[model samples]
Target: MVNQAKAHIAIPMGDPAGIGPEITVKSLAKAEIYDVCKPVVVGHTEVMKKALAVTHTNLEINEISEPEEGKYEHGTIDMINLDNLNIDHLEWGVVQAQCGRAAFQYIKKSVELALEGKVAAIATTPINKESLKAGEVPYIGHTEMLEDLTNSRDPLTMFEVRNLRIFFLTRHVSLKDAISQMTKERVFEYIGRCEEALKRLGVENPLIAVAGLNPHSGENGLFGREEVDEIKPGIEMAVEKGYRAVGPVPADSVFYQALQGKYDAVLSLYHDQGHIAAKMTDFERTISITNGLPFLRTSVDHGTAFDIAGKNIASSVSMEECIKLAAKYAPNFRS
Candidate 1:
């Protein structure tokens, strides 16, 4: 009720062989979702039909050629059907190359709509990596594929769990390789980027906390030298440049402190460190927001649960959260 305008969010039906379709159906079933955004699924009609049958959701699918035709009303699911998926071959709880290809196609369509300004933002579902590999998709995951499609360079990944926000220095790289890439320059660069990203999300004069790479931040060089050699200087450099930055805060306590409102956000040095902290705090609510893209993009943090695809047990909390975030931040995307 605070804001009456509803942003249009594009939902891509990820690998039909997975839980994407089901979750999308379940999420769209919520009347609360229609309150803030007009969501149109960029997927196949047959796939969504099958999902509606499985989930027993009462909403009717209204396929539109574009977002402009959407009714954007409760009890009606407006979709941009690609008609790419053949429902006959889809087997839930399994990976299929066709499903992977279909999923990629859905994302491609979503990106196209985003680029054309047909939608305000995109709230994505889980796509199977094994399926992507089997389908011979060039990019490994959504982030990389999005980066390539938008021609955006190194899009920053930010996680929002409640009030706490986290940014990774590196993701999907080997632990050793990630460590090697951590230098004063890279850390400093990430700090500045994080500041810019926060501002885009409507935060002004944000405070950033950079996590240490070692135990107790190297205990003044006893535990590891990376903190002393690289991290400390990075914070100092950001501060010198007039950025509101702090820490080499210990990985063990930094996330907790940030969650407690001591800091606006934390800059995790590697993948697992931040992943563990975020997932531990709240797994289902930890949504990933890709900042620096041409348009706003949000995703469910979890992957496609192939093990429990069609039983209708997958929690739609994350999917709902993803769309909510897209609606919340869509106004900020320069794209």
Candidate 2:
């Protein structure tokens, strides 16, 4: 259990043009979120104000200069305004460099807070990749950015949800590129990370399922030998290390069994194989937790819905679920 007085959680308001600010306002308007932990948003207050007006949410913005000044009160949105970007120049539904810079600042501030022990955990909203690049912060996604910022050499893994965890052996790469990166050593690292993540999630004995790269798990090497050569050997190494792992399982059937609690987590050979299954199974409720970070980090599984920005139609379900999961896992790192 965490000491209520010292435990605070920081949420970065993602791309100002996106629905991040809007959903953040909605999440704070609820009374239940504050009951478990103190949630302080690390972004500009003006953007949140605009979001409230756009979404028609009845949330009062508490502009805090520091973490200690936060109200931590239910039905009130507290912010540690970084004051980096002016939202006036930001246009909803369009990518811009300024918005990207703002998003990056928010994440940076949250990371500092976590490292300083001002916050117990960090939960982020979706940031647009194009905007990030437009701002000159060249990162493909949050996982890569966080890894660079934290200087973590350990294998960075993304876990989709608690019961049905999945990791992308390769992210933001073409199918052809993914094939090249899927070496035996990298696959072994993924398996190791999966094993450690399951233990962190309180799984006493995790049954890891590995997915095949090609169709039908390579059809016994008829299609591709990745399953037979790289993936199978990785799983064998993990099992040798005392993990109850077995696979190179066909991608199609693996996720189905995982959802039914047959496996603790599935390590997909590539991005879509795991993501399609996770999102299809439960998109709204899915939470993405980044493993191998110094502190607990969780984010919304979905991306910035540029199409629905300022329309007051974006769903806050995923954001709220992400917050809950962050709070749920924060206590695990109290030491």
> All candidates' TM-scores?
0.97, 0.93
Per-residue lDDT of model 2, residues 1-335, tens digit only? 23674368889999988989888887887787887778989988888888999988887788987777878888788888887776568788899999898899899888888877778899999999999999999787787778888887654556565467787788778989998888878877778777787687677778888887778888889998887887888778878877788888888899888878998888887778888888888888788888788788989887889999888898888888888888887877666
Write down the lDDT of every candidate, Cα atoms only: 0.91, 0.82
Give the alpha carbon lDDT tens digit for every residue of 146-249 in model 1.
99999999999999999889999999999999999999999999999999999999998999999988878899999889988998998899999999998899
Evaluated at residue 66, the lDDT of candidate 2 is 74
Candidate 1 achieves a global lDDT of: 0.91
Candidate 1: regions farther than 4 A off: 1-4
Candidate 2 weakest lDDT stretch, 10 residues: 154-163
lDDT of 2 at 319: 84
